[model samples]
Target: MVSRVELFALIRRDARVEGLSVRALADRHGVHRRTVRQALGSAVPPPRKTPARSSPVTGPLREAMDEILRADLDAPRKQRHTAHRIWERLVDEHDAEIAYRTVSKYVARRRPEILLEARNRAGVMDGFVPQTHLPGQDAEVDFAEVWVNVGGVDTKCFLFTLRMSFSGKAIHRVYSSQGQEAFFAGHVAAFTELGGVPAGEIRYDNLSSAVRRVCFGRSRVETEKWVLFKSAYGVTSFYCMPGKEGAHEKGGVEGEGGRFRRRWFVPVPKIADISGLAGINDRLAAADHAEDARHIDQRTATIGQDFALEAPLLAALPVDEFDIALTTTPRVDRYARITVRQALYSVPARLIGQTVRAKLDAEELVVLHGSAEVARHPRLTTKGGQHLVLDHYLEVLAGKPGALRGATALVHARQKGWFTATHDAFWAAARAKHGDQAGTRLLIEVLLLHRRMAHAHVIAGIRVTLEAGSVSPDVVAIEARKHAAAAGSTAGDVEVEPPGPQRSRSKVVSLPERRRDSDLPPDSRPAPSVAAYDQLLSNTPKKGNAS
Candidate 1:
């Protein structure tokens, strides 16, 4: 093959400069006359073309392989068939004698095309209409999973984000789970932070907390609680289509979740619990003002400026905030524990067989017996875990003092610093003096004193009693009362003395006179001086030297 430049040079030289005929140049160069004429006509060479070939093994099965791959588009992700599985199915079910690699190659090549065609048929496209939002008119809500280092333990946490579409402002909160209580609480917090509710509509996917049943298109059978919440706030809600088809509806919140995480939680916030997370969210909320540079309305104005314009358009807050707690009646078990959401919490042993109303929220579990709250526990995140308060079991332990030695409640108390080193020292001394059961009974009595006195007073009393080497419960009680009285006085507990009758004339009373050395008692008297006798001896002695 001759280069284009060389062909052009030869053609020009022979045809134009040397006056060579096209037939003469073609014969001399052993080339076709048409080629020489084309070269002479133009300097550019024609591109090479290759003939197409069909694979004997895979060509016949192309249609069947394509159908199999296309059917996978509707199958569950985990249940979808792989290329190797497809090959096995072809050999076993279809009696095709094709090699596995040939089928695999064809499936790999055609699977993406088949999936693309399926999406196209389903109306999933790249085309999106730019949205225009009115002030306080719309908001998008979504939850994203993020990794958090909580108390040195790495775990996945759900970040609930509500983004106002008009202002591009968002509220990001962290929760242990994406349960209904957390969902409701997130909304309450976001609304409170924004100072009002979005008036037009709040958009959400078919989250189970909101939608009890997803109907055709955007219609939904919403949960009863969700409906009540919507009514309470006087706001409307719009459900997006389920799954990937509806992601665009809440795209604002989805993007905000990512942006906020990258900007604030990039270091993977190290928090102890939900309260710590709340503190971080408060800081993030304040820092959001710095995002004023973010443009809204396609660079027409900044988000902060737009937000200022929209803040006034929001609906006034409701008279009262919603109580985002799940109320349930749970029977306390023999262990004096009630199971709420698979977590066990203790109540008084007397309520062991009773059913108590348990109000559970994101952070606390409050057990109420009729009108009175009997037990309160920090909500547990781990499933099947137990949170026991030693005080709740103290009454039962008093009866069975033997159980106090290695009880779970005792361990939990020690871990929580409720049972301090002073308590341990007192218990040890009591056990050494009395028998184990008797000593433990005494310790239980001391522990019961914590009900009346403050923990600090009880601890101080224990230290005082230990120093006095009196480990008796009576001594501890006395010391605790004295400490409590002192604390009360120091804390400004004042008592006014009654006013007495006015006496203008005062009585003159004299104090006892001071006694001389001679009038003092024998044991208290001072010794006489010997300085004069020593001076006489110095003048009379020195016998050896004076003689």
Candidate 2:
């Protein structure tokens, strides 16, 4: 159809500019001559009339569909009657022989109107106003699940995020699991990195780590440790509503987790260990300072600038940091190992049959006997896992030499490079000479030397003994002492007297020292002779054989 303005312009152009008649204009523009006359008589074109059409399929079903849709006003939001449901009802309930598509078209057209009317009746609001946050007043904390390649294994890791509400500054750390220890450790680390805790309140969802039980509405039974943590930081805790309804309460961190993951962890970070992950976090924190262009309080200011302003307003850090380790008293088994979180860690053999306190942290398991820390191991994630230190079981292994050959502890020791090929070579030679049991026993004795001697010296001793073709424990000990003394002398840590006649020497070295029989290095004094003791014994009185 031609527009009114265009038709009027065309008629005027033909009549005045071209000097064409109304009939010619009508013929050229493909219109009736009377219509062309009307256009020439007045600038306005006549309105087009609507043609009446019959609706066979939807004509009868329109009212029924509208009624069904209108009835949805009282139904639950999720269970509201859909257009397809209306179509099914029309066929099944009303026996109407209309095409489903025809019903779909009519229902789709009318459903919006029905919903509008329903909304008007219900008096529901459609949107929320943007909220303004005060500096150092609030922060939000949340965890997001991300996949990270740890030690060549693709594992699910928890990315903990704490976002300041005012400046939008955030701290992100990844952990192997979202356990209570990791949760607490994340907060401690984030607070330390941020330099302070929010002075007013820290908002969180109903995380299991914080909330022990959810009561009606916003009431909660908080976990005792979480309460202590908040107290230690001198910050109050606020919980968002449950589920999706409460998501907006901690919206800052909720969005931060996604944004950070997309920006930094897009390709799934391949980290070698937790320390590597911590390094990544450090880099991310440094990069966050450069993101200063983001807006705060409707003004163009850097997040770093806002954070600087808010930093002084935050609460001071406590003098003592909260211990985020999970403490337990586990009894040391006969193997001198304590079970913690389904993983076995070895303590000193002397602690066997005693209950020692085990502090299980995010990355380490520390075993304490009374006040002293007896053992520490990298916290294991696998169930039924064992982390053993060969030194911890050396005494036991020495007593039972047969157990040393195929011991699981020995396997772990070899895997860690603590037990080297030198140790194996020494053990094999000793066993060849002294027989299996005695040779293995001798190897265990050499292993015990690690306690008093430096590891490098022990290794050197092993090499020296192996080269000398003697697998004697005493010989290894002598070699170890010699190596230790040589190293100390070379490093200028020990003084050796120059060789001279014993009578000419100004100082008299003790018998034990001169003979090197007191475990001192041979260089301390001249080697002693037993010939003098034999002569003295022979010269002594022999009453029965007196001549």
Candidate 3:
């Protein structure tokens, strides 16, 4: 069957080529004279248009639907009304007889018009402009929440990403917290890893780690620590406009985090502890290097190739490193612990009731008495968490031996693998041999060995003492020192003598045997002769009489 286009072509051809009249052409083509006239005017058929159809059922509820959609302009984006929701509202509130499809069709056509009207009234324009970035001049930094299975426990962590605008080269780091220290640390790590800092500016949202308060427009009151860090590194921070308006400003890093997470963190990387972040970051560094070979968007050069061109333009790292640790003076409690960031860390018992300085970074807390570091512990994530080192309370436990059985510090020590089965075995044996009170005191003395000796050496000492059927602390101390000395000895310290009746005695001569022969200079000196000395001796003998 001929379609309208084919029919039109036949009519037009008959009229033009054969010189048929419009009426005759229409009749021959079995069509109206108007159709022949239309074909004569244009070969192409006009597009069919849909006429406006009146909806009797939905027409009465138009005002209510418009009201709902109009209100949606001020509503939160996620909370705004949908077409189905509008239909539901109409049915429930006004008992209007309206099908969902009718309401959906109406909304699909009207919503954009309404939004455009609103935009015009508010005098706002919406459009995206193409961006061009200069090499080594601009970067974007942001922190994104990531889930990691660290130490067999699912933990929420923060991932810091700094992406260069021109090259698309990005540096990523995973941190336990998004604290100020972590913020500062992230920049330092990125600068060091990238071999230099962005020369122009690093863009950021109003993160609390950096910004204390958001002023009008792009102005921000930054935190003191952030200001100091930026100044020290000679960095210029570009704070984006507050809230959702600013999100697009750092879109490079914002999307980079998600892209990186999907590519690398798909399995929610398993790690041993917070300290294991180092390994994950090392993997990310390698991934960054691997990404250098790939091109971004329509760029001709690979990311790595672009970075190579940009690297030399970047600013050099600062000679003086900025301190990212938060320092505080907290008085040691009765438990011989200091409270930092609402977490407890045990210090020496002697420092109880005294204020000691504490320095906290992203991963660890260091407690100090004057210049001497008294204790160190991994930083805790949860509030009110206690990290007690059993060694810290040993001095107190020595006075009250019974408390050692039920001390919280002891429980934590066992959990941390600091108090092992060897220590427990030695404790039980000492109790069996010396009785409870005396045995406990002896165990404290043995525990004291850990303060001065390597932990493995102490454990070895305890094992040896138990195998020897002895519970004496002195015996364990002697065994521990012996293990320490044995571990400290090198193969070079052992005497290796050449095959001879008499051993070479000179330390200088021993060097040849100890060192590789190939490494030493050749023995090129001539053998000493006594012929000149013999004449001098004979002349001196004769001069003894003459003089």
Candidate 4:
């Protein structure tokens, strides 16, 4: 770790005074000859020529091993991990220099430790114990998997789970990753559902989120953050020992996750979107609590009934709910929504594309511009999902003369007899012609037409082609067009152009604004062009055909 500059100063002193050889200098310095030579080089060495430290996995073979691991980590195998097998694989597939014996040593050193594997627990007395607990005293937390639909796409999900030992009351939330923020948010949400933070020890299955160092036995050194959280709520957290053959120690909630999955997640919850998953899970956990369990140690009450009594021990909600999830500042997009977990969340149009802190939790995502709440939605569960709503960008749509989209609220703004029969076919055609983004935006603009017309007129015009009970954005636009012609305000409300002859493929030219260096202040970079455009439009007038 010694700096080369300091080493060079010593080398120069030795070279000037003692005239020591490079090897001698290296010996005196207790370093490599090459290092000593570099320090005392008469000619400067090119930075590119410097050699990095040596490791067992080096050069092409190391890269090959990395690629091999990445490519086949999930390959079907009983145990694809023995040193001989890995060595054979390398020789067969990648032409590696790796010896089978050396591979064994390497794998022994690098293989991640697995502590919890399923096995018989009948004879074991060291696993999770004291399952039947006094009401309001103990809770266990873990993670489980389920399937969910995001933006109409089905994907596997990771859910954090919490359960009360006495009442069998449980709660869980889904997240995209098992990172610190999600773990913290899970704790927050679980505690909230428990009605208060439990007063007794909080138990954990040796997850890295709560423990930093696993000791030799069933003990662990908690992380600074974990310690702080426990102290904040004054609950003792215990981590199960790593690699211990004890099942009973963490058996209660340890098996609960699998039980829940088998009972509930066999077929992933089929839903339209992630926004609906939170409510679904909330209801799902409630149903899970209705199960009946009768044990001698457990009181006469069922798990659900016992949990009801334990619920009272939880602390009351603080004046301000503690944001357990980590927060990073985010900016709104041209659509006036902040993207989190790949989903776009609608914030106020006034704050579109502006820098704001995003507090992410398992249950909900909150975007804030200073003290103002920009947007809130069920927290997303994927890295690349976009949560979009037209209303978040309404002001911006109203400002730009031809901004294609209107607010999401436009979906509801049909007037009576304003747009007439057979608009559905045209609307569907328009949407099909435009991309979803452009189509949704265009629909929002149609809804804005209701500003001048009565709601009944908007409905009437839209219903011309569809049933009276049915509503469509295209119908609203048709009604608005009729009223615009009669009022003479349509010409002024929007540009006189007639929507460019309704091209099948609506050409969207998104003008991205450049953020100069000046716009990037300390601790904050200039907002991206797309996000900025979203904000700019969100602040514009939304009542007219301006978008």
Candidate 5:
């Protein structure tokens, strides 16, 4: 089908080329004579005119609608009248008949004009100015929620993004939570990745991790730790205005988080544990580096090229790194556990009833006895959560074997895969041969072997003893040492000490040996000639006959 403009072109062309009369042109084009005359008058088609239509129902209600919309200027923005509400009011209060669609079309056209008039009267200006950032001068920081499959379970994670404003270069880190420690850890990680901090102020929202209180105007009450951290790094913080009003102040990072999540976390990354985040973060760093070669928006240079100009301008890192871990001294209870941030973490059993130093960081808790590290566990996210290490209670278990069965540390070990099925099998066999108490004690002795030997070696030793129908921990220790020695040398035989006096002296049966003939490679040489030896014997036999 031809458009109006096309139809007009066709009409004018036919009249010009064919020399057809206006009546014939109209008949050929299937149009009116007036249309052909108009086409002949001008090459362009005239705009279609819409005739004014009278609305008897809404004509009188216009005044009422205007009054309602005008009254909305003083009302709260959310509570103001809508088009439908205005129509309903007209129907209920004035007994006026008006279509909702008519009211809606009128309101849509008139409301913007009312707002413009009001803004002009109030002398208010609403517009955005183009922003320019100097190299390494400005950056934005923000946190966004990311979902990941951890241990086959969907888990919520917090993603921290720090983007350079000038180059659009960004560094990101993921955490279990957005707490103060995690916030500090993110900054540390980003700084390490970027190789320096921004010389100018970094923009941020009113996150509690940095600001203790959001004060009037731009003044903010910063947390004590945040102040110290800034001093350590020589950083300047620029807090954006509260809520959506300040969102545009740091638009770079606000958009970067979404882009990164969509780019990398689209499949909902799966990790066996929180430690898997290190691998994810490594991949993200590579991705960041790869992006440096790509352009951002209409920029002439690639991001990496721009970053090269900015990288050198950044402030140098401090000579001494800041220790971001929170230090606390907690007394160990009778259970040999220290409570830190409302979470229970096991230390050595000997530390019970004693005070120990605990350092809590974003990802882990380290317990210290004097200058030496005694215990370490992954940080707990929830209140009243407990992390127990089985080795911490080994000494206690040795004294009271009954406690091994019901020990919370043992349960935790099983959950963590630290305790294997081989251990359980050996324990059951030992308990059957020796009584429960003696067998459990023997298992505790074997468990102690892990401290001196590798875990796999100890497990192999247990298997060797169990196969030989021996329930002795000493035999397991001897076999475990043999495994350790065998691992050290592959081409030579391993020497193992004999079992202790308490163990049975019976020689353990061994597998059938290989044949000697089969052990040697095939020899291609013929049988050695004995002709020379025969000649010597004949020469000596004549002397024997004379004698």
Candidate 6:
């Protein structure tokens, strides 16, 4: 393979310098005489390394992949994957039947594929060389596979990422599930990570993310939104003909993605919280931009070094980030709440029965009834769970007893075991003595103790007394000697018990009287219509009912 310019030069050198005929020039170059003549007249030099058919042998994997490809050959190229990429995607996305290496070997053995990458033109390889970068002129984008366990179910998810070819900077964001929105959002986020849009061009595999039509030699079939997107950023998009051994197209970001997954996303990555995981990702992307890599562009020292040169040419940031976040239409249900993956989020009474958008990210959920942001909460991933909050739905508990069980986003209160088993026992004992309202108040006290020590220690101390059937969180607090900042060790495994079982029996001492039903407040909003409470004698803590 020779560049057209090279072919022309071959003829030129032979015809004028070496006294060779045009036919002889074509013979030496393995090109037609006309091609040789055409190359001679071209003003632009021919591309280096004219691509060629890579396949040499075929086997079972080849046969299998061929059948899959053959079935969809005429439909479109973008819709059907090229051989090499299809190989990677099969194993990466679907856990296909064969190894990716096998798919790659088989595709390479076929020489020319009608899918995956574009076909190479013969003779272009004779004197071909790759193009040099021009500062902020080009960027490459790619996808990486990440494994995550959302709740108890383990599954693989795709991460969309972008790497500036000149600067080495990359930006990435996760998708709960990948489809068009996730793919589009990745592009938006990558640009944001780069601080602005690159002025040159961005390269991508004709991923379903960017293209819909896959015509041969017709490499320009692109989606409307993507066309508009690139046009807005003021950059050109180039495509390789499908079924070609043309790794050179998006090679920069392609290799970058693999390097990044191995260095930053792999080995062992654990996150108890989603936001923390995102923070680590952002840090890694920023680090890649600053560290110089082995390959250096012509003008700039390295990709990171070149980024400074290119930054000035990129598009300006918009007023708001593309809320690439997903939103779902749901109504806060009858219980004054909206349910997410089984965990319920309480919205206000005014929004009840009205449809709202549950704008969701990997870590948080925001409920909006149209334009107004009504409520926000951490999104849960499991089914059949309760994250009930008393304050968010306090309107439901007015004048009712035992109606409120959960503390509000009191995770803010720095409370330990706000609704754990020990809390349950203490509540039971308190209700036996002072009624559910008193039990709720006692629950608040244990949480407040967290200001002095870790919540677990507070709960451990609570259990020591509450487990013995006691209502005095204060007495329990005193017995545990947690009067001051606890001297307990910080080891996560430490065991601390709540106060004593020393009982006060026999001659009854006076205690504060419990409120009667008529004593219920009159000014609060009426609760959701429901069954009435058991209204009976409640003037004092019933010692007979005491635990």
Which tens-of-lDDT digit does each residue in 1-547 have in candidate 3? Answer: 9999999988877777899998799779888888788888999988878999987887888888888889998899999998988988888999887789999998998899889999999897878678999999999999988999987999999999999999999988888999988888889899999999899999988889988988777778889888888888889999888767778888888888998899889988998777788888899889888889988888899999999989999999999878899999999988898899999899989998999999998888998899999998888989999888898888898999999999999998887788899989988998998899889999999998877777887888788778767888888877776565556521222222333444322122234365656777777889888777777776565645774
Least accurate 10 contiguous residues by lDDT in model 4 = 113-122
Query: What lDDT tens digits, residue by residue, belong to model 4 across residues 1-547?
Result: 7565676788879988999988888889898887777777643443555678676554456555554454444555565556676788788887777667776665565444221111122332323334347777777777776677765677777778777766666776666556667788777767765668777766777887777877877667777777767767667676655443444555677778787777766666666555576677676656554454533243676665666676777665554655466577878676666766566677767775578898876567777778877566666655565555444655566455244324243332222222333433435554686755565455456556545555554544554423323244654555445544444444334432333332331221223322334575454766556764787787788787666
Sequence-dependent TM-score of model 2: 0.69
Residue 43 C-alpha lDDT in model 1: 77
Per residue, candidate 5 scores C-alpha lDDT tens digits across 217-291 of 999999999999999998999999986669889988988899889988988989887768778878878888887
Better of 5 and 6 by TM-score: 5
lDDT over C-alpha atoms for residue 18 of model 2: 93
Task: Give the TM-score of each candidate.
Answer: 0.75, 0.69, 0.78, 0.49, 0.75, 0.50
Tell me, by TM-score, which candidate is best.
Answer: 3
Who is ahead in lDDT, 1 or 6? Answer: 1
Candidate 3 off by > 4 Å: 1-40, 51-59, 76-92, 95-117, 123-125, 425-443, 464-475, 478-547
> Could you give candidate 6's per-residue lDDT for residues 1-547 as a string of tens digits?
6655655666776777787777888888787877767666774655568687665433434565666665664666567656666777566765566666667666665545633333233324323466667767777776777765533334455667777765666676665545556666677767766778777767767777569888767465777666666665565676654544567667776676667667666644554443344665566566555454645445436555567778887877665545544567877777777876557777776567878888765556788876888787765545664454444544444444355544344452223234576666676777788877876666656544554556565666676665455667676555444422244344233344543454432221224332334675554777675344434444446889776
Alpha-carbon lDDT, every model: 0.81, 0.81, 0.86, 0.61, 0.86, 0.61
**Greater-lDDT candidate between 3 and 6:** 3
Q: Which scores better on TM-score, 3 or 6?
A: 3
Q: Please list all clashing residue pairs in model 3, or write none if there are none.
A: none
Question: What's the lDDT of the predicted structure labeled candidate 4?
Answer: 0.61
TM-score of 3: 0.78
lDDT of 5 at 445: 91
* Cand. 3 Cα-lDDT: 0.86
How would you encode candidate 2's per-residue C-alpha lDDT over 1-547 as one tens digit per residue?
8787898888888899899987789889988888888888888777778998899877887888888788776677799877678878888988988877887788777888877877777895446668888998899889999987876878787888888989898877777677789889888887887898898888988889889999998899999998898889897888889876677677778878988889788888787654466676677677666555566456777788888889888888899878899999999999899999898899989888999999998778888888998898877778998888988988887788888878888998887678999999998898899899899988988888887777787888788777767787776766666666655432123233443343321222346556756665547666786876787786887789776
Best by lDDT: 5
True lDDT of residue 60, candidate 2: 80
